[model samples]
Target: MHEIQDPLFKPFALGGLELPNRIVMPPMTRSRASQPGDVPNELMAEYYAQRASAGLIISEGTWISPLGKGYAWTPGIHSPAQVAGWRKVTGAVHAAGGRIFAQLWHVGRLSHTRLLDGRSPVSSSAIQATGVNVYVAERDGTPGFVQASTPRALATDEIPRVVDEFRQAARNAMAAGFDGVELHAANGYLVNQFIDSNANDRTDAYGGSLENRLRFLGEVANALVEGTGDKGRVGIRLAPLTTLNGCSDDHPEITYIAAARLLGEIGVAYVHIAEADWEDAPHMPVEFKQQLRAAFPGALIYAGKYTAERARAALEAGWADLIAFGRPFVANPDLPERLRIGAPLNAHDRATLFGGAAHGLTDYPTLAGSAA
Candidate 1:
């Protein structure tokens, strides 16, 4: 037998789970979850099972409660039906010898009333989020992007309920057979609304100074840890500099490093950094990366438009413990094997990226003779 000397192929331990390689398939929303209920289905199960070769797989953002949703056709874990749906997905992945984690999410102010059962959306503050469109369906079932509705600030008394929602989501994820859970604290969602300076402007415990702003995240992280029953089963995603959906911190370095330290103190398994991947976006500063490493005591995974070379370089430089690929995995279900052997990847159909069936979802072919 021949051994691969490449660092990407090397196995590493992420908390209590031992990963077979350094390639991670981070969460990417395909919006194909069964509609009328927002439940995971056979199609989603097959889609995930096909890509189980990654060192770890994180499921697409899953809403924790009815109000946590932000888009159409995305799945939720708040209901028994939704949990049953996710069971098939997790079973399929484990059958293929893969480990998967659920990405618990809430959109916060980045939501429209149509998706909220004609009710106003809630967030850290009563601010209207703009600059990015939320995906929704009209009365006629025609789906398109629309400006989000102005949201009401979560009442001081109501904040704990939302945190409990996250806790419940983690418990549901474990019941659904997920190996672990990742809090979708990144992006301009509920947790990020509380974390980002510009998005949150409250005089309450969840806003004002950095420590106050970080209060919500700490509470949610602690809840998730307690709900999961093991600190090693929890992970967090954070975007320090990315301003997508208007979620930029006043001082990204200070904000995210402190977040890393907080998660470290909470003893979550890992912290996944989501870099700005838009065209011509500025690279994350090395000094900031170094500080994040110093602050956090768990595995560090970075994702954003990473190529094979860039992934390897990050691994060798001690910058990232694991490297995650998003778009490439869509075109190549056997992405890990393809990367291991330097095979050409198939191009993904952008037209079929969102709200599609098997065309771009599970129809991607694998290596000719291999079943992966």
Candidate 2:
């Protein structure tokens, strides 16, 4: 009998880069940037470099500007120091022979005044992200999660300036020696605040209709595509059914399908769909997956709670071109190698998931380093 192939190890061609495997390290916020400037540091570089076995590594969500930030200690791409800091990260990953992309992010409404330099958070509407909290420093200067403050609605004229922020952030990513940039349009952040129905009640050119809601996404996608000098170098992450950050839609199916088709029309390189991961989260309909596949011409990446069997099944079924593992990569920096050999994986420390030293960040021993 012939040796069976492992689907997870299959090579994928992403734009000009040839990915060595199908395992992707999706963006996850660790809030570990250096203080005083929210800059990426050598510790962050070591964390990413340790996981270089991944086919493609998408860095943590990086704020595009100070006004776009919603969390304390998260890195930004707009400042010269920030760019130089990210250079260390990209150089480390590349030195380890890994391809990485910077995730450009803007948390529109999911912010506190403390995180915004006393400025109210801005969003598509003046709505509070009830029941949600963001990382902020207390009066004593200790960092903690606080109830998100209500956001002010962005004026129609202010939208373009926000788009330009993302455009410039992409240029900064290139300057930082990154291979590409991924727009964090997913979750309940800034872009989602605009795309979701309840979060947006504006009647301007950017709201009140499906086409209007998509205008911001389209403009930003175009800006990243044009700014980066390659349509294939740009990717988008979208969350259609997630309500984690107080964002909801009356009709997610219709809205997202139209969004996917618009992205296809714009000739983007990939679209990453973040499947809801809550304990009782509803299953994503097979029909919607097929529709997304038909609508977007490039690669499709899906991230959620996934096992190797389920991931292989999804790839065999043909909707997802790449599968991203979040926590798995956290505890198992050599995750791809471990999976290939069917080795046991390490458990991640929940307490150290964010804002910590290297103890939980980069101390996970690899298969060879651990005892049997």
Q: Which candidate comes out best when scored by lDDT?
A: 1
lDDT of 1 by residue, 227-340 (tens): 899999999999988888878887889999999999999999999999999998877988889899999999999999999999999899897999999999998999998998
Candidate 2 RMSD to the correct structure: 1.6
Record all residue pairs in model 2 with backbone atoms less than 3 Å apart, i.e. clashing: none
Query: What's each prediction's TM-score?
Result: 0.97, 0.97
| lDDT tens per residue, model 2, 1-372 | 554488888889998889988999999988889988999999999999999999999999999998889888899998999999999999999999999999999999898888887899999999999999887865675578889998999999999999989999999999999999999998899999889998999999999999999999999999998779899899999998888799989999999999999999998889999999989996889899999999899999999988888889888899999999999999999999888888888999998887867889989998878865
Alpha-carbon shift of residue 292 in model 1 (angstroms) = 0.6
- Residue 262, candidate 2: Cα error in Å is 0.6
